[model samples]
Target: MFSKKWMNKSTNDYWDKISNLKKTIENADAIIIGAGAGLSTSAGLEYSGKRFFVHFSDFADKYGLQDMYSAGFYPFETLEEY
Candidate 1:
C-alpha cells in the first residue's frame, strides 16, 4: 500500500528522472522510443471516464464496453460493429 508521503516522494523522483531524460534526448543525435499505454495516454488516446464516454458512447451502449482496452479484445459480429 502507498502512503501519501510515499506517493509524493515517488512523484518527485519520477519528475527528476524525466527531466534528466529530456536532457539526454535533446543531446542525442538519434533516439528510439517504445510506445505503449503511457505513450498512448500522453498522446490523448485515453479510453475511459469522460473521454471514453464522449467519443465512444455509442459503442459502449451497444457492447457494454467499460473501457477502450477491453474493446480491443471484444469480438463483434460484423466489420461495421468492429
Candidate 2:
C-alpha cells in the first residue's frame, strides 16, 4: 500500500516522479491501470489523419465529423445509423 504522504507529494520534478513510480510498481502486489483513448492515441492509434479519412470517410461525408473523437458525440437518430 502506498503512503498517503507519498501519494500527496506534489512535485514538478520529472525524474523524481519516475523514481517514485518505479518504487511504487516494485513494491506493489498487483497493479491495475485504467487508460483512455489518449493512451492509445499516444501509442499510434491515431484518431485523425489518413487513417480516419480512409476508415470513416463515409461517416465524415454524411455527418460532417472531423475525427474519431468528435464522432463519438454525434447524435445519430438510431442505433443502426450510429
Candidate 3:
C-alpha cells in the first residue's frame, strides 16, 4: 500500500523530479522516451478503485474487465465490443 502522503503530495513534485533528472537524461543523450503506466503514474495518471472503475465500466459490463491491465488482454468479438 502507498502512504497517504504519496497521493496528497503537490503535483510540483513530479515536475521537480523530472527537472532533477534532466542532467542524467542529457548525459545519456536520450533521443526518445518510452512511457507506460508507471511513467504515467509518476506524472500523475494513476487509476485505481472508483477512478479506474468509472473510466472503464464499458469493458467491465461487456467483458467483466476489472482494470485497464486486464482490459488490454480482453479479446473482443467485434470492434464495437472494444
Candidate 4:
C-alpha cells in the first residue's frame, strides 16, 4: 500500500486558490512543468466511462474494473488477467 504523506494536505476554495495560482504563475520569472503521466489525469483528462468500456470491455466483464485509475491498483491474479 502507499504511504499517507498527503493526509494533512489541504486547499482553499477553487476560485480563490486558482486566482492565487494565476497570480503566482504570472509573476514568476521562470516556470517549470512536469510531464508526469498522472498530471493530465489529475487535470480531468480521464479514461473512464464510455472510453474505458470501449477499450477494456473484457476487463469490465471479468473483474468489474470501472476505470483506468482503479485498474492500476487492482491485484489481478495473473498477467493475462491484467
Candidate 5:
C-alpha cells in the first residue's frame, strides 16, 4: 500500500481533511465540492502518464513530463510556451 504518510503527513493535510469533509457532507444540509487541483488529485485525476499524456501526447513529448504533477510546474511562463 502507498504509505498514508506521503498523503497525510503534510502540514496542510488537505487530502485527509478533505476526506473528513466528504463524510461530514453526508450528514450536512448541503454539500459543495469545490473542484481544484488538489481535489482533482484526490479523485485520482493525476496528471501523469495516463490522464495527461493520454490526451496530451504531443504536449508531454515536447515538454518531457512523465506525469501531470511535473507538467503543472513545467517552468511555464505561459500556456503557449509549453
Candidate 6:
C-alpha cells in the first residue's frame, strides 16, 4: 500500500521515486514481472466486445452479465454457480 506521502508529490518527488526504482532494479539479482489481465487483453485476449459475446453469450443471457470482468462481480448464489 502506498502512504499518503506519495500522494500530491511534486515533479522532483516523482523523479526521486523513479531514480530509486532504477537503482533498485540495477542492483537486483533477478526481476519477475507479473502480467495480468491488462497484459493479456493488450495481447488480444480480450474479455469483452466480440470475444465476450462469442464465448459468454449464454452466460450473458442467463445472468444478465455483460463481460468477463463484470461476471466476476456477479452475485452468484454458490461458488459452483459462479
Go through the candidates in order and give each one's C-alpha lDDT. Answer: 0.86, 0.88, 0.73, 0.84, 0.73, 0.87
| lDDT (10s digit) by residue, model 3, range 3-23 | 666466675868978787887
After superposition, which runs of candidate 4 have C-alpha atoms over 4 Å from their true positions?
1-33, 42-44
Worst 10 residues of 2 by lDDT: 4-13
1 versus 3: better TM-score goes to? 1
| Full-model lDDT, candidate 1 | 0.86
Tens digits of lDDT, candidate 1, 1-82: 6556643355577897899989999999998887779887888776789988888999899899989899999999889868
Predicted structure 4: lDDT? 0.84
Best by TM-score: 2
Which parts of model 1 are misplaced by more than 4 Å? 1-32, 42-45
What is the C-alpha lDDT profile of model 6 across 39-59, one tens digit per residue?
987888867788898989999
Which one wins by lDDT: 3 or 4?
4
Listed per model in order, the count of residue pairs whose N, CA or C atoms clash below 3 Å is 0, 0, 0, 0, 3, 0
Judged by lDDT relative to the true structure, which candidate is superior, 1 or 2? Answer: 2
| Per-residue error (Å), model 4, residue 24 | 22
Which candidate do you rate higher for lDDT, 1 or 6?
6
Alpha carbon lDDT at 12, candidate 4: 52
Off-target runs (Cα >4 Å) in candidate 3 are: 1-32
Span of ten consecutive residues with least summed lDDT in model 6: 1-10
Q: Is 4 or 5 the stronger prediction by lDDT? A: 4
Q: List the lowest-lDDT window of 10 residues for candidate 3.
A: 2-11
Query: What TM-score does candidate 1 get on C-alpha atoms?
Result: 0.51
Summarize candidate 4's per-residue lDDT along 1-82 as a digit string, tens digits. 9987766544553678889889999999999886986888888787789989999999888888899889988998889866
